[model samples]
Target chain A: MSMDFGFDMITEDEYQRQRALYEPLTEAVRRLIYASLHTDVGADAAAEARTKIEAVTALLETEQRASVPLVHENTGRPLAWANPAVGLRNAIAPPMVIHHEDDGSCWSEFTLSGAYEGPPGWVHGGICALVLDHLLGEAASEGLTQPKFTGTISLRYLRGTPLGPLRAEAFVERTEGVKTFARGYLKDADGATVEAEGVFIRPAWARDAG
Target chain B: MSMDFGFDMITEDEYQRQRALYEPLTEAVRRLIYASLHTDVGADAAAEARTKIEAVTALLETEQRASVPLVHENTGRPLAWANPAVGLRNAIAPPMVIHHEDDGSCWSEFTLSGAYEGPPGWVHGGICALVLDHLLGEAASEGLTQPKFTGTISLRYLRGTPLGPLRAEAFVERTEGVKTFARGYLKDADGATVEAEGVFIRPAWARDAG
Candidate 1:
């Protein structure tokens, strides 16, 4: 999760293209990260990683902080769209690609990898809730003109979600002033694995601005 | 979260020593990882990381899979004791160093960095629940002579948890048959930020084996 930071200065199309171009490298980095965890290698490898940090920091300093594009220029969305857990660009995202339909409902399809596992072959339960809560909140925001923040969420793990392809669907159940109620469930090939209900609030920024 | 893998074959003292020795390197790697995400460097930087993977993988292959210690051998705890979210060795864990007290309660102290941020200056709400759930489950398991898994967790975000030093505490509320009830909250310098309640189940492995 990230803030809009209101730093978007590029065209949305350009941002998307850059995100696409940069994805594979990011993924390679993530895989290597997990590999680093298991290796019994000594300080030399870790030192190399640390050494690269200074050079990278110098490159970043070249870009004026305020001028850097923080969000997608077209969508006003933050760079979190690259987050591994739910990032669209990241193959690692339980990739929860949400589609908001004309009928006031939303659904997504994605897969989980070994990285997200909790129990031997199962997706972490917290990750299940993470995807569900994000989907439900997005479902709630589909009708609104502004962003909504998750206020509370309740999750019931009916069964362990396996580490592979899965689907989820959510819809707004009701609305009372600032609160939007939503419910959803996750399913693997076998059947529904988890369910969630959430209340999302139109935060002060959205409420006051919109 | 990871499986115990039953691969722990080392003495508890050996495990602790290795954990202590390797912790700083793991932390440096983690910080570099988050830094990598934001760096605008070209292929050279990413290539350097890729090159390191092969050497690391070779070192890991040297150890026979059956002999590798995957967790704290004495406790049979998965190596995730170093996981970024709750790991003591990881700088990102919120560290959540839990202390199980004589009165049947547990508490932890930790901090959140920019890597864990969401909603601007606050820690991600899902992460807040992740820590609370883990803590509550651990608290529930304190009196039991067996392991437990999280059954259900309910969280309410009363306020955004600031991205800095924070504290969390949990205690078993009650127990019935295989279920243990626990509750806890997260606090920053100002006050409580999030509160949670959870039910943890002692699975058949813990029930039958222990």
Candidate 2:
């Protein structure tokens, strides 16, 4: 018996709603991250951004209710780990994603609220992992050299990946036999920050089988 | 109310049974992985191991189905993504792992069966991502590192990571403020094969409030 499962489609309106809800405050954090990497911004900057981000996210989430539908039970949403539905209880995220299709490159956005803070108020280290995982995974599966999942992934945080309105972009790098390689960057609004590379493998099961 | 979740301990027999059911095959694969990496042997050596691994794991699963419920729903085990019950019905694993205790490193493993085969008899690529995520996350959370998740990850698959009994190890290299920097390697019994690096962040949310 054969069946069709809907795995590749998500609406644009839903995307906008999520984006508005996340309200990422991207530009500010981007500039701040750039400075830290290029200049001797010190640890205080991460602390400052964490604090500023938490306050902003707190205001956005105040109106949110803990009781919400869990759209992601399995195929974990990228930011679902911290959703209020789960009680906004833990801000850390694992390497899952909420993918939206794009023509040229894969794009995704998520917000880091109080739950993700570090220092006096900054995004936590683990949260960065979740963000990158979601973004990179989505990138690997789409418009890339070939659809591969992470065989191995590496990251260099050049600087603290501040909290709040963050944006991440991923593009395919190259391919070899059953392996596909990719590179990506996460930025608030500043530019050229938090770089990463991932190996997407088309498991023996899914490969050629398609 | 203080609550105690009955997960902190396990019986010695249970440990042994678990090892018998899970570890030996993984070890065999690990040995092959090491050989594939350090020696002049081609990736085909790992391929040979995967075949042996699949045969062993299938028999183990059939033999232990009654004694050791490998499926998550049947056993009520928390890390269902790696459980066969979620129905990959194969040897490949998802990249997410939960129920990690204070082991200093969090890890999940599965012996690739025919179900995970990519080539005539190889494991799938996506499954590799699932394993690495579990490894790197565990490594970051180890000791004074404050258990941060992956902020960013980079992976280099020097060659096809053969499917078989495989071992992935991750450990912290250093830390920067609230972020822990770490690297991990996936090795077979012989030596190093796939290497990875990541930034583990202790999200702002998990910190104790003053």
Cα lDDT tens digits, model 1, B109-204, are 887665555455666666777677777867887722346767888889897788888899999899999999999999987878888888888876
Measured against the true structure, the TM-scores of the candidates, in listed sequence, are 0.81, 0.38
- In order, what lDDT does every prediction score? 0.64, 0.43
Q: Across residues A102-127, which tens digit of lDDT does each residue of candidate 2 receive? A: 55457656665433343223444434
| Model 2 spans > 4 angstroms off | A1-103, A118-120, A143-147, B1-210
Best by lDDT: 1
- Place model 2 in a CAPRI quality band: incorrect
The candidate maximizing TM-score is 1
Per-residue lDDT tens digits of candidate 1, residues A1-210? 345544445677766665654565445545544544444544564455434533443443342222232555555445554343455333234445677788879888886665555555666666776678767867887722346777888888886788888899899999999999999988988778888888988877667676
> Fraction of the real A/B interface contacts present in each candidate?
0.20, 0.09
Q: What is every candidate's C-alpha DockQ against the true complex, given to 2 decimals? A: 0.35, 0.05
- Cα deviation at B86, candidate 1, in Å, is 2.4
